[model samples]
Target: MARHEDRDPLNEEDLAQIADLPKVELHLHHEGAAPPAFIRGLAKEKSVNLSGVFREDGSYAYRDFVHFLSVYEAATQVLQTPRDYARLTTALLEECAANGVIYCETFLSPDFCGGGDLGAWREYLHAIREAADAAERDLGVTLRGVVTCIRHFGPEKSRPAARCAAETAGDWIVGFGMGGDENRGELNQFLYAFDMAREAGLKLTTHAGEWRGPSEVRSAVEDLRVARIGHGVRAIEDLALVDLLAETGVVLEVCPGSNVTLGVYPNLAKHPIAELRDRGVKVTVSTDDPPFFHTNMRREYFNLANAFQWDADVLRELTRNAADAAFCDDDTREKILKRLET
Candidate 1:
């Protein structure tokens, strides 16, 4: 029998081959997706002090997950209007297209975009949707929105975010979820907001089991009743909980590179994505925040292949899984799946 290996080194050609594969991403953040240079230019235009957000080498600088969240929000300070978000959406989707990503669902926060006002949120949504339409027409990459609540901001504040999301639930904004410090607020606290979005005909997902424990995953499922989970890799700690995830067919939008960068795991080999997949969990790969983690869709695929010896067939299976679990409508999903098939 062949001895199991944690990783297999790949040359540039191998990485290039992986880079050409069609991809789908189900976990990404709108503000967090901003390119470093883009944010820097905005900061320069506004004369904001973003010196703390970057390293000496001109990359995002943060000490840990909490600090990363701080930097992520800090970068949003420059993005203060509908036009700013429009530019951001266009640039982000174009980047995704360049990386061979055919479909991507990103988390957008009303807290940053509109300060939780429904009217203002509508304006921001209009700008974002216009950019998405342009990107789809020109770049052949479909972009969808998942309106996200900031968990650290508490449940009372999540109310307006949910209201904003509920008002705009449609073809572009197809789902609702939460991101931020997952350790804050009890799951039941956000139940009303989740229910509101769900009643408004939006699919549900939430960040869990990344910065917290398996119990958080249970709460996200039992209380919020999310159909998908963002970074539920920590569920592996609880065998029964892992079994529950498998039994329920709840998709995990696993961002292995982000997990390692955030110290959720020491490194790629220590990440539980492959193990969770082997246990029947529907796991899909994404770059939660590409620039912040210094990763892209191509890097994600290449690293996963290197770490797990996953061949083209395995990578395609993961892409198909993302398409199956995407928040888009059936027509969009079918289109993306057809691209993956070819």
Candidate 2:
């Protein structure tokens, strides 16, 4: 496993110990998980150029957050068809299973899959759903989709995405969320979209307190009314906000490796995940986009253990927290928790 230079690195034996710890992942991106080699292959097939997306070592390359977003979208250019999405789904689930992620809810965008056309969205969803079903059967990794809208696309464009999400609320299409450039639009402007998803009975979450501050997270819960905050770790900056999050029981999908890799914090020791947890806030760990961040579920567990001196019990608590926060149905959640118990 690759380690960030400033942090104390884990050896092979340390990584091997956490390899089979069953986990639930709640904040992964569909397009972002595309293997670099897979994207390169698709770019070749479509005759598209992705020179800017890869590094000399054949891994993703980007200098900072804004450029990372550009590179992420650039990689998505290869995923132009429903079948393409199905292939991506299969590859992602296989990687998740290998990392001991039994249940994973990934953000899938209508804009990317079908360009906000409901009919086309259904076709793409069906392809991805079929792939997920096969993966659960063969790989033992249960998959769920959170239909997400790109926040940077603005409110007008977000409506079609919300409509698509609202129309597909079900066991497989479990939640609705917004994930993109968080700094682009005012949170209130997206309230109507969240309302649409809420009316359709979709669980809500949004990216906030990541590139921005605690006020961004505060507004997401207050105006947008999300049950979960993607990367709300920055809430640690405000003790009162931390208290409020604890009081309200809003879960934060904390992604440490992504934070440190993006320079959100200097290192895991400085990251706010442990502080947030200590403050009585509901916190669960996930690798926001594993490969892009150079992490997987096992690595996430290993790093947390090393940084916080967490034992097996602490790791299990995180798994249980994730299973509880999972967007799946009650029966599915029960089954997952039962697995964790065993």
lDDT of 2 by residue, 47-73 (tens): 999988999999999999989999999
At residue 83, what lDDT does model 1 achieve?
97
Candidate of highest lDDT: 1
lDDT of 2: 0.90
Candidates' C-alpha lDDT: 0.90, 0.90
Task: Score candidate 1 by TM-score against the native.
Answer: 0.96
- Model 1 residue runs over 4 Å out of place are 1-17
**Prediction 2 TM-score vs. true:** 0.95
User: What tens digits encode model 1's per-residue C-alpha lDDT throughout 130-178?
Assistant: 9999999999999999999999999999999999999989988999999
Estimated TM-score for each candidate = 0.96, 0.95
Lowest-lDDT window of 10 residues in candidate 2? 1-10
lDDT of 1 at 298: 90
Query: Alpha-carbon error at 137 in model 1, in Å?
Result: 1.0
